[model samples]
Target chain A: MEIITSSKAMQERALQLKKQGYSIGFAPTMGFLHEGHLKLVTQSLQENDVSVMSIFVNPLQFGPNEDFEAYPRDVERDKKLAENAGVNILFLPERTEIYPNEPSFEINVKNRTGVLCGRSRPGHFNGVATILIKLFNIILPDHVYFGMKDAQQVAVVDSLIKDFNFPIELIPVETEREEDGLARSSRNVYLSDEERSQAPHLYKGLQKGSEAIKKGEVNPSSVIHIIENYIKTNTNGKIDYIEILSFPNLDTLEQIHGKIIIALAVKFSKARLIDNIILEIHS
Target chain B: MEIITSSKAMQERALQLKKQGYSIGFAPTMGFLHEGHLKLVTQSLQENDVSVMSIFVNPLQFGPNEDFEAYPRDVERDKKLAENAGVNILFLPERTEIYPNEPSFEINVKNRTGVLCGRSRPGHFNGVATILIKLFNIILPDHVYFGMKDAQQVAVVDSLIKDFNFPIELIPVETEREEDGLARSSRNVYLSDEERSQAPHLYKGLQKGSEAIKKGEVNPSSVIHIIENYIKTNTNGKIDYIEILSFPNLDTLEQIHGKIIIALAVKFSKARLIDNIILEIHS
Candidate 1:
């Protein structure tokens, strides 16, 4: 596989490959390869003539107090994992390569960024949106893969593509999970031995909430209480927020109708883990 | 020449043409074609295998109280002019076609939008930036043309292309003007006969400023005063603003040691006219 570190080189290579009639599939990520990221790479490889993986631990997406400096990075391990997943090209741009200077304009995400993890991490989605746009312009991929694990991000990207009329298609993959039902995440390394065991309860609470909604719990508050109580009683963790809102839009829903997402973030001793489940309500 | 009114059909046509190895050159404009718009179209035709023109009087660029409804539009005339200029495809998407829903995200231009016409008209460049991005995504042109008559816009677009790393090249064509030096503009139609006679002074002031700077005037304020005074005394027009700043960045300049732009706007009885000249300074 070819490894590209320069943004100009990546763009030029993309254009040449495109001219040769290749349908490029792109998977953009921060380094430290996990099962979830590998799943996206695997899908890209299956769907396109060429699969390109980009590993950028974007500084713009991290707030001043966030874990930008300590974000796990293993370029060597990521390179092997990506090649094993059948990636044709590996784009590893430095911060300067991505941003030659401080950007004069920003892609401000005005909607769907105020809920879930976005509430706690301000300017995070703006950074994500901006970097992805830059990547899209550089890659010119036929299809871009995004995991539903970052479901809010997926929603924001959906609005971006629709609003901006990007030619590329967005393929959202399902969240990969552990054997114990905990959603697979790189942050799983941040958990202590006790926190690791309690991580499974986060998903359990979401499952219980899903079961209640399926069993005719219509009021949003009553359903939220059941899930909140599950996490509070079963896990030694603090509930950051447990929210039930219209899927993707995150708009307030008075009743169980249309699509809805039950999402929550839990703060353990060493890590903050988030999980969610989407449901279709007809009643 | 093919005329496409549907945005989807236009995008699909552009893609098919591109896949057939045709290089597209795009010239986006508001209709009521003037010499300036024709110059951009002419350049696009000369540069690429296919020249595509889009005539959209974007409401997003006009303020709520501005001349959106009264903005001059002549599609029949514009169609003839574009074909005469060798345009292959003409995209004429209506406001509803371009914007099916109100955009959830806006491309706010924080840098160059605060000066010249942008100083008086807020959210104007943001609208221009937003619409151009959409058009670029749809057209996917290899090169896009813009007339430098609106110099600040050229600068804003410069930053946008660089910041976003758009694969398309920006070709800024020189401002096309009449023999009397009044820049060709559709708004020129709004000027009364008497007001039209006084309009040439706007470009004259730009010339006077350029001459003064070339004759060793290092102070920006002195050059600005020379132009502002000339416009105020020679024409029965109200001076909107006369200012000098670094080219593109629009940053405050303490001394004339680099590329600088002397730009001005004068509001006549029925129309507002703007002009500028870029100067390179030494010592």
Candidate 2:
């Protein structure tokens, strides 16, 4: 495995692979590799001749009050985990290298980004779209893997790829979970022991919502209310948002005829945990 | 020459060309090809194995009051001109093809865009940056060409290329002009015969400013006053802005040091015209 820090080097390596007819798969992450990220890497290795994983703690994605400083990053450990997971290249760019100066250019996905996480953390999706574009251009990956943990991010990236007509294929892997059903995330480390015990409630709430919908709860508002009630009763966590949005586009729908993403964000102490489940309902 | 109207078709063709070891040179334009645009196409033909020119009158780049609808476009004439100029592919995507719905993503370059034309036409550079990025990604060109007539645009694009690390090279072709020194533009068609005659004065004013700076006049305010005075006296033109800014970056300089770009925009009776000249002065 080759470990590269410079953007130029990564591009050169990606180009070389392209020239040699090697299909490149990329997984972009903010270090602190969890099983969730490794799942993405594992999928990339299965589908492409070369897999490149980038660990960038994008400062732009974090709001002024967000956990940019405390966001987990362990380079040596991440590199080991990535290599073991069959990643061919580990791209670790410094903050200055990723963002030389204040970024002049921003990529914003309209409408889709103004809700959910986008509402509380303004400019977050713009930052995600911008850095993802930079990563896509730099690595020139044939396939890019994103975890379903960030459901809105997946939707935004999918829209960007289609809108810009980037040749990259977006493969969204299922959310990796702990044995106790808590979604695996680096931020999960921030939860206190008691908060950790209650953290699984977020995903449990999503599952309950999905089950209710599957058992013929078609009213969007009623579904949201049930999920909100579940969170309120089961845990002390503060609900950021409990939304039943149409899958893929994330548009709010009156009736759930197709796949709907039951997504939510909850805050417990210093940790903010987000999770979702896609419900495909027949008319 | 192949004519592709769909983004998917053009990207496929571009990919095929890449696989066959042909480097692509691209000229992105809003049609009604003029001598300036032809110069860019000619350069593209010379520099790469294949030249792809796209004509998209991007709505995003136009202000609410700007002449987006009235922007000159002659597809038949443009096709003949591009074919004659040795263009390999001419991409003419319809409005629906480029903007299916309102565009969600926007690319903005700060500081560089808020001067000259950008100041007058707010969100113009954002539109330009967005479409250019889309074109660059779709065409996957080896070298992209732009005319020096849009001097601030060149700087913004140059900054974008650097900031985004797009693999394509940016080639700034010299400004192409008519015999009387009026920079060739599609918008020139909007000028009445009398307005056309007065159009050359815009260039003349730039020349006067350049000569004054060459003769050791360094204060921007005095230089701008003289240029504005020339335009006001020579033609029925309303001064939009007269700025003597640092070249490339377009920043306002207290004292002219190495190279300065003297740029101005004027509204004639029937058309808006802009011109500039870079003055390299020795200390």
Q: Report the number of the highest-lDDT candidate.
A: 1
Kindly give the stretch of ten consecutive residues in candidate 2 chain A with the minimal lDDT sum.
A106-115
Q: How far is candidate 1 from the true structure (C-alpha RMSD, Å)?
A: 1.3
Q: Which residue runs of candidate 2 sit more than 4 Å off their true CA positions?
A: none
Candidate 2 CAPRI classification by DockQ: medium
Cα lDDT computed for each candidate against the true fold: 0.89, 0.88
What is the number of backbone collisions in each predicted candidate, taken in the order shown? 0, 0
DockQ of each model vs. true complex:
0.84, 0.66
Q: Least lDDT summed over 10 consecutive residues: which range in candidate 2 chain B?
A: B102-111
Q: Which candidate gets the maximum TM-score versus the true structure?
A: 1
State model 1's lDDT: 0.89
lDDT by residue (B171-255, candidate 1, tens digit) is 9999899999999988999999888888898999989988988888888889888988888888888998998889978877777
